[model samples]
Target chain A: MKQNIYDNPTFFNEYKKLRESGITYNDFIEQPAVKSAISCLEGKTVLDLGCGTGEFVRYCLENKASYVLGVDISKKMIEQAKIKTENGKADFICAPIEDINITDQKFDVIISSLAIHYIEDYDGLINKVRNLLNYDGVFIFSTEHPIVTARKEMDNWIKDGEGNKLYWALDDYHEEGKREQHWYIEGVIKYHRTISTLVNTLITNGFKIEEIQEPQSTSEGLNKMPKLVNEKRRPSFIVIKAQKSCVT
Target chain B: MKQNIYDNPTFFNEYKKLRESGITYNDFIEQPAVKSAISCLEGKTVLDLGCGTGEFVRYCLENKASYVLGVDISKKMIEQAKIKTENGKADFICAPIEDINITDQKFDVIISSLAIHYIEDYDGLINKVRNLLNYDGVFIFSTEHPIVTARKEMDNWIKDGEGNKLYWALDDYHEEGKREQHWYIEGVIKYHRTISTLVNTLITNGFKIEEIQEPQSTSEGLNKMPKLVNEKRRPSFIVIKAQKSCVT
Candidate 1:
């Protein structure tokens, strides 16, 4: 069966098995890069949206976060998260982020990894994030880059019968929204928006951007996984660190 | 005093002189492609926005349009238009499109060429076009393509002293909105939005898109102006035909 997200009970189990065999994309590339972006986790209340398999939660806990909440739209993913939890230090909830109350609690840092691209309405979610944060609180997130998302024929040209490389085709770079992507799995619908729309939405919601990053292979990553070097040609993801600034 | 739009008495006079001397960009491209997008203007009321020198109005008049309105931000352009206009067959108005009340007169065809990029808000203007159109009324417009508009450098690469080719650097393709472009005129601010944003906005505002075109040189146009061939590399303008469908 094709693995669907959020509530796929066997999803993490199969994925973990793949990672153990060194065939996983995230274990080598995105996870480590996203982990390093979290600065000063100690004594902070953190909310991790789309916390699939609770990787970031463990990172925050290892870094001594005071309290952590891992919210995932997938019930099965949250089930896996719960198995790793103890005491009241870390928590996992199975609910769509759009339905979360967020009123009874406040967070010092809010983070989502590879999640926001699924969201259809950006402005509404961003505005909601602004309202959920404390004054000067931080929000850090990562999603698929527009270039990666905008591509229709994400296929590189294959060699002909004589082993001659054909053209590497990338079309409709400017067309955005709701592209079906085939990666480790097939038929994954992802929403695309320009970097300006993403950044401008943050700015409109009173956030001061700290960093806009396109993660690439470190020399160490390249040493371990040589194929990672191809990221320099075209970025696959974008990570942004922004702060809620007090604005008039 | 620096020449301002709408009432820039010197803007068109200087620009016309440049075109006369073969020093203008659009004189060689875009204008003809845009004019041809108007399939039929016979017996239709045509409203042309930012109708500098009323060229489209004259075209529509020659094609036997019922009536035509040429509204330009530049008074000097309208003044020149007036010299060519005669007794209510054509009329010219000097006003910003945003401030103009389009409700009073419904149109069968609305065309804006090389103008919407200067306007900051696209959704509002497109919605206004919808409201001002009769059922099945068509709105055809052309603006600077987002790729050209997003360019910060706006500079072509040149050979160095040793005749080495310089970089054809195209960075910031994903960033949208305001970019300062320099061509014949210096420091001209043009707003850029991705093709998705532009098309999606039109769809969102209840206009059924008929065609989306990147206006390039025809073989005939290339013969008339050899420099027009360059449009094949990177399109300078996008022409869209959207209709306000009679839907409940």
Candidate 2:
């Protein structure tokens, strides 16, 4: 069965609160970086995997995509997305990304933002994405940086007496498997994969990596959230843009 | 002028002793990993960049490579390579890898072992290698892992009160530039680059990433050097095997 931590009431409430907050890491660091990877969306068909609340789905519609489909496992999230988005160009599907039955549909671009780490079978997902993309289509995604995901405790840091983060405490990096950690509640599951595994999986599945970014906070972001300055020390995310090459 | 720390008597002597010890990281960890990336060499022409003392050069020749050219910036290293290698199939060139004028010759395989970080212009070097490779040629190389080179200190480990390493101190990881550290002597220079930069450079240069390995210590390695167990916590090297696709 698919893990649906997003459906948990307490966790969903806390996550919704965090997303609404203007100063969250996703707001200050991830969104800008992910948006930058996206090219002109005019007339393009888009698929947003793990599309929570349809933020990117709306962005795609705003950017003039011909059509956009948002997929998420949480019924609550899909309901929220449907309530917020009223455009005919936008559609929502409440299904686990791992089991999405959208193979009949093809997309000009497929994007997933900060959601890939939640999926257990990364190779299968990549293969599915490859099949769902039209020839020369693009697959762009942002995931928690391997450095952040290498340990069981997400964002593991060594702190000083005064609680200032000294450095990231990295361990069990080579051990690739399920990592259980607590967010607002206990037992939020994510998989730890090394950078090599991430890149090699895409290459083996017929994606030609085009651009990669480990984005730092913008000046505006730093002005808004001073703690974001620490991003210079360690990246919180890794974004990759790859094109589907000739079928292998 | 290129950095030739390898020719410094103190550094050279120290390095020679470490390689001869057969219990060092290279002997127990890196060599085995690097050699595993290499395939059958029968009738293939090979080039070894930054080939120190002709180890890989001899390996290729012994495996039936038609010709092997070993290039190093250090005259002393090339001299040692010459003195140790008597095979007519092998030749040594004492020139900076950055300055080698080898556009006239192309090789079936180009291998560099743990020497890429010393070069400044990575993009230029990769372009040069691409041009010097036969179509469908393979370029396999290993370098200091980005995590190790991210800081000015080669291995910045935060240790406990009793000197037990707690975790790696990772900072300035996104900052890509020249890094100066101490080896056998002061002012040893190396370049720092993120994993994104490394992978993107290869992709942009028309090489399809075939395999990327962050190798763990073998059981044999663990028996020889117990310190190598730390490699599981964090990788010390990254080995990549990239194949040159159609010229682009």
lDDT of 2 by residue, A1-248 (tens): 99999999999998998888867887778888888888789999999999999988998998999999999999999999999998699999999998987757899999999899999999999999999999999999999888888876665777899999877677778888898888888888988899888988998899977778888898888998898888877888999888898857
* Fraction of native contacts under 8 Å reproduced by each candidate: 0.00, 0.73
Global lDDT of each model? Answer: 0.71, 0.89
lDDT (tens digit, per residue) of candidate 1 on B174-225 = 4566777654556677776765567667766777555556656666667777
Pairs of residues at least 3 apart in sequence or in different chains that clash in candidate 1: A6-A74, A7-A74, B6-B73
CAPRI quality of model 1: incorrect
- Please report the candidate that would top lDDT against the real structure: 2
lDDT digits (tens) for residues B16-105 of candidate 2: 898878778887778888888887899999999999999889989888999999999999899999999985999899999988898578
Write model 1 residue lDDT over A117-170, tens digit each, in one string. Answer: 988788888888888887878999889876566546555333479965322223
In angstroms, the error of model 1 at B161 is 37
DockQ, each predicted model:
0.03, 0.70
Q: In DockQ, how does model 2 score against the reference complex?
A: 0.70
List TM-scores for all candidates, in order.
0.52, 0.95
